[model samples]
Target chain A: GPKVLQIPSHQIIDMGQMVTLNCDPVSNHLYFYWYKQILGQQMEFLVNFYNGKVMEKSKLFKDQFSVERPDGSYFTLKIQPTALEDSAVYFCASSLEAGGSDYTFGSGTRLLVI
Target chain B: GDKVKQSPSALSLQEGTNSALRCNFSIAATTVQWFLQNPRGSLINLFYLVPGTKENGRLKSAFDSKESYSTLHIRDAQLEDSGTYFCAAPSNSAGNKLTFGIGTRVLVRP
Candidate 1:
C-alpha cells in the first residue's frame, strides 16, 4: 500500500510563533489534502491542493495558514502567529485522482500551541 | 445536522462475534470510504465503495447511493479490531474533498 509520511509526529510551539508541518505524500499521487482533528472531535477538511494551487478551503483554514509543495518536494503547511485554538492533530492525504478515488492518509502530526 | 452521521457512537463486542457500523448521509454522496484509526492514532483505509458491496477477509462494506447510506460489518471480531471506525464521502460533485463522520468506537473484548 502507498503511504503518506508526516514529519515531527509531535510538536510544541509558543503562541504567535510560526510552525511548518511536513508531509511526504505518495510519490505518484497528484491531489493532496489537509485535515484537522481536535482532541475529541471529528476530522475536518482544511484545504485541498492540486497543480501547485489551492483548489478549495474551508472556514477552518484561517488567514494565518498556508500550504505549498515547492518544486515537487514535500507538501508543507505553515501557520504563522499561531493561536492556542490551533492545537490539534493534522492529517495529510493524497490520491491519484480527484474524485471517487481512494486516499492514503499519514499518521498525522500533533501540534500543540501554548 | 451532520452531513455524515454515524450511529451507535460506541460498541463493545466479544471476540468471535459480529458487529455492524452504519453511516447516514445528509449530502448526496456518490462514493464512500471506510477507515480505522488504531489506538496508536494511525488511520488505515479499509474500503472504498460505490453503490455496492465489497468484502475482504472478515470485513464487508456496502454503499447505497439512492438511500444515502453506507454500512461496515465485521465478522468474527478480533481483539485487534478495537479502534475507531470512520466513514467519509466527497463534499462536492467533483469528489475532490471529503466530509467525515464523527466515527464509531469499537472495543472487541476477549
Candidate 2:
C-alpha cells in the first residue's frame, strides 16, 4: 500500500513560537490534505493543496497557518505564533482524486504547546 | 451540527462476533470513505465507496447516496479490529475536503 510520511512523530513547543510540520505525500498523488485531531475528537479538515496552490481551507486554518510544497519536496505546514488550541495531532493525507478514491494518511504528528 | 454524524459513540464486541457502524450525513456527499485509526494514531483506509456495496474479507461496506448514509459491518471480528472507526464524506460545500464524523470507538475482547 502507498504511504504518506510525516516527520517528527512528536513535538513540544512553547506558546507563541513558530513550528513547521513536514509531510511527504505519496508520489504521484496530486491532492494533498492536512487534518487536525484534538484529543477525544474527530480529525477535522484544515486545508488541501493542489498544483502548488491552496485549493481549499477550513475555518480551523487560521491566518497564522500556511502550507507549501516547493520543488516537489515535502508538504510542510507552518504555524507562526502558535496558540494553545493549535496543540493537536496533525495527520497528512494524499490522494489521486477527491472522489471515489482512497486517501492515504500518515502516522500523524502530535503537537503539544506549553 | 455535525455534517457527518456517527452513531454509537463507543462499542464493545467479543471476538468472533459481528457488529455494524453507521454514519449519517447532512451535507450532500458524492463519495464515502471508512478508516480505522489504531491506538498508535495510524489511520488505515478500509473502504472507499460510491453509492454501492463493497465487501473485503470480513468487512463489508455499503453507501446509499439517496439516503445520505453509509454503513460498515464487521463479521468475525478479531482483537486487532479494536480501534476507532471513522466515516468521511466529501460534499460540494467544501472543495475536495472530506467531512469526518466523531468516530465510533470499538473494543474487541477475547
Candidate 3:
C-alpha cells in the first residue's frame, strides 16, 4: 500500500535547457531509484540513492544528471543541458529496504526535449 | 549482453486462453519482480518473488534463483489483461538495482 508520487506528469522542454523531476517517496521508505523508459523500449536503471548518497548508477546516468534527497524531503532528478536522447518517461520508485522487496513506482513523468 | 531477456516479444491470445511469459537472467540475480504496463503507461506491480512461486487471482509467478529464470502465468485471460509485461532482476551485488527485460506485449482478443 505504499505509493510514490511524481510531479509534473508531463514536461516539454527545449534542448540544452535544464529540467528537474520530483518524486515523493513513501514516508518511511529508505531507498529511492530512478528509471527511464524510451518509447518502445525497456525500462533502464538510472540511479539509486540511500543515506544521502548515491549508492549505484548505471551507464545511462549521464554526467549532467544528478539526484538528491536534500533534507530528507522529496527526491529529485535534475538534468542540465538536456539532450534529445533525454526524452523519455522517467519513473521514480522507492522501497522500504534496499534489497528483495516490492518497489512502489510513481505513474511517471513524460519528458520531451525538443 | 542483456542481463535479463524476456521471451515472446509479443503475443496475441483469445479470451479465456492461458499463456505463460518468461524471463532469463544472465547476471547473478537474487530476486525478481513482475510488472504490467497499462495503456496509459502506468507500471503496476504484479509480483515479487525470491526462488519460489506465488499466485494471486488469475496470475501466478515463479522465480528460480539457482537457474536464474522466472515465469509468469496468466489463466483465463481477459481483454483487460492486454498490456506490456516486464520482468526485472536485481543483481545479488547491486543492492536492489533492477535490470529490466525488454518486455512482452500481450493483446487479448475478445
Better of 1 and 3 by DockQ: 1
Per-residue lDDT of candidate 1, residues A3-109 (tens digit): 99999899999999999999999999999999999986789999999999999999999999999999999999999989999999999999989974569999999
TM-score against native, each model = 0.98, 0.97, 0.97
| Residue-by-residue lDDT tens digits, candidate 3, A1-114 | 778999999999999999999999999988899999999799999999989999999899999999999998889999998999999999999988887476889999999999
What C-alpha lDDT, on a 0 to 100 scale, does residue B35 get in candidate 2?
Answer: 96
Candidate lDDT values, in order: 0.95, 0.92, 0.93
Q: Which residue runs of candidate 2 sit more than 4 Å off their true CA positions? A: B93-95
Model 3: docking quality category: medium
- Candidate with the larger lDDT of 1 and 2: 1
In terms of docking quality, model 1 is high
Q: Please give the clash total of every predicted structure, in order.
A: 0, 0, 0
DockQ score for model 2, please? 0.69
Check candidate 1 and list the clashing pairs. Answer: none
Among residues 3 or more apart in sequence or in different chains, the pairs in candidate 2 whose N, CA or C atoms overlap within 3 Å are none
- What are the candidates' individual DockQ scores? 0.84, 0.69, 0.75
Q: What is the docking quality class of candidate 2?
A: medium
DockQ rank order: 1, 3, 2
